[model samples]
Target: MPAAALKPKPSNEPLPTQSTAKRPVPLDTPYAPVAKRPLPPGRPREWYVTHNRRLKAMRLAIALLDSGVHQPDQARDETIRSAARLIGVHPPSETTCHMVRALMRYAR
Candidate 1:
């Protein structure tokens, strides 16, 4: 390795200064997180699949809206998937993307 490579780069971060008193965060009523309650036992397989897909579509729609995509026309598959990753959910399937668009269409 060249001698130049041995030198450490300076950090862009400023040296820590004594923090001032933090202002109280404004209270905004945000959406509540999913309830911890488990799904009831013994549902049919297809019921669960449709149920989960509905949930995923709803989440993706909300994420897209939050990211300023207000119209169904603006919600392409890739756009919905990007929103999925942003909200920390699994990427939605093609069908779920369709459902998200449907939800957005209905909401307008």
Candidate 2:
């Protein structure tokens, strides 16, 4: 709502009603350009690897879900890799593929 359309409430007036409450506004655009931000410093090497693996697994799992692959058993490495490709992520490692299946199993 435009600020100019609002009227000042008198001191004796009751609190604003639900009709005046804020509504969720839709975004003007859905696509966001990726930002290039550096990772936080001082993390252990193992931590970085695990963090990256988790992110890859999450993206792959969501893609599989969107493509109607729900069960962990149905998400074999080849299937997971194909999902990765469909989503434009690099082909994941065996460990990352295992993580993807683990994510699917945990979803329920």
Candidate 3:
């Protein structure tokens, strides 16, 4: 008998093809955190106590300055006093106020 007549026919099933493209993956290295925890819902604690007082004091001082109640050039001590009063802190001296103003300018 011949070799062709002794073998069965192969089936017409499809063969699986593999992809050659590289897939992207996220880096697994650890990184330092940059975000802070979000504040809780509702009014913040600082708002009622610190922030409110500070804003009121600043507004009072600015109003006084703008209304010509005190001269800006000579009222550094007064401004600091008014701010301290609004915030319920001890009134700072003229020198302290000058330092505060200079520090504030530098901070910005």
Candidate 4:
């Protein structure tokens, strides 16, 4: 093979100038002033506990559904409810159950 054939093709584009180059924003730089919104009111301890429980249940349900150990249709509701109970979600609320079911359906 000829040495000329090994040479890289040259680009037609002009090199970028300092004015055209994009520089990273400095850490000390202040961004545009964003409107500050008041924080929402906090919930009760029970609410937090319930919320955590629901999240745990949702995560567990997704894992179980993805495991493929069970059919998507057969005994799905019962399985989710049982998983929730095992995960210390107590008697899972209707909303929690519904959310779990929806997640299972969507995942499949």
Q: Report the poorest 10 consecutive residues by lDDT, candidate 2.
A: 24-33
What lDDT score goes with residue 54 in model 2? Answer: 93
Q: Pull out the clashing pairs in model 1.
A: none
Query: Candidate 1, TM-score vs. the true structure?
Result: 0.67
Q: What global local distance difference test value does model 3 have?
A: 0.51
| Worst window of 10 by summed lDDT in candidate 3 | 25-34
lDDT of 3 by residue, 1-108 (tens): 999998998755434563423434333332233355554558878655554454434544543443344544555766667655644556664555565454444433
Task: State TM-scores per candidate.
Answer: 0.67, 0.67, 0.30, 0.39
Best model per TM-score: 1
lDDT of 1 at 18: 36
**Deviation in Å, model 1, residue 83 alpha carbon:** 0.3
Better of 1 and 3 by lDDT: 1
Per-residue CA lDDT of model 2 for 32-63, tens digit only, reads: 33465788999999998998899879988977
Question: Regarding TM-score, does 2 or 3 come out ahead?
Answer: 2
lDDT of each: 0.83, 0.81, 0.51, 0.57
Which residue runs does candidate 4 get wrong by more than 4 Å?
A: 1-54, 66-72
TM value for model 3 = 0.30
